[model samples]
Target: MNVTICVGSSCHLKGSPKVIKRLEYLIAQHHLEDQIELSGSFCMDQCSLGSSGVCVQVDHVVHSVTPSTVDSFFQEYILGGLAS
Candidate 1:
């Protein structure tokens, strides 16, 4: 999966930078660099909610996400038992 984080002005202020760093570290630590691709993104038009959140994209499907809920999102969806 490739995780694209919106780093627009709003997102930056909301704390996407920290999320990016945390995810990067996790990817590296888990040796998921090959399984995942993390990148900075422009506004996905969810700026109304601003930076207080994150987003996860698998293939082309995008999910509105937040830092606090990322763990469950990953565990239940990304790394969950369901096959894509």
Candidate 2:
């Protein structure tokens, strides 16, 4: 899966760095380094939409993600796919 996190100014202020860190740690913990490709996007337009969290794209599907929600996102989108 290709996961892209918005690092635009708005997202940065909203805690993108922390979200990225937690996501990295979780990906490593799940040994998904090979299965997942993580990257940063300059702007994804979610900021203009007034999203509460950082804008993240999983396989081109965008989502509002935060550090606190990283675990569930990973579990459902990443790990859950592995189980199936």
Largest TM-score belongs to which candidate?
A: 2
For candidate 2, write residues 1-84 as lDDT tens digits: 889999999989888899899989988987889988999999887796527788888886787877788788888876876677
User: In order, how many clashes per candidate?
Assistant: 1, 0
RMSD of each: 2.7, 1.5
- What are the models' TM-scores? 0.72, 0.89
Q: Name the 10 consecutive residues with the lowest summed lDDT in model 2.
A: 43-52
Inter-residue clash pairs, candidate 1: 14-51
lDDT value, residue 7 of candidate 2: 96
Candidate 2: pairs in clash:
none
lDDT of 2 at 6: 93
Candidate 2 vs. true structure, TM-score:
0.89
lDDT to native, each model: 0.67, 0.84
Candidate 1 structure quality by residue, lDDT tens digits, 1-84 = 766888777777767777677767766776778788778888778775443466546567666566666666666655552345
Name the regions of candidate 2 deviating beyond 4 angstroms: 82-84
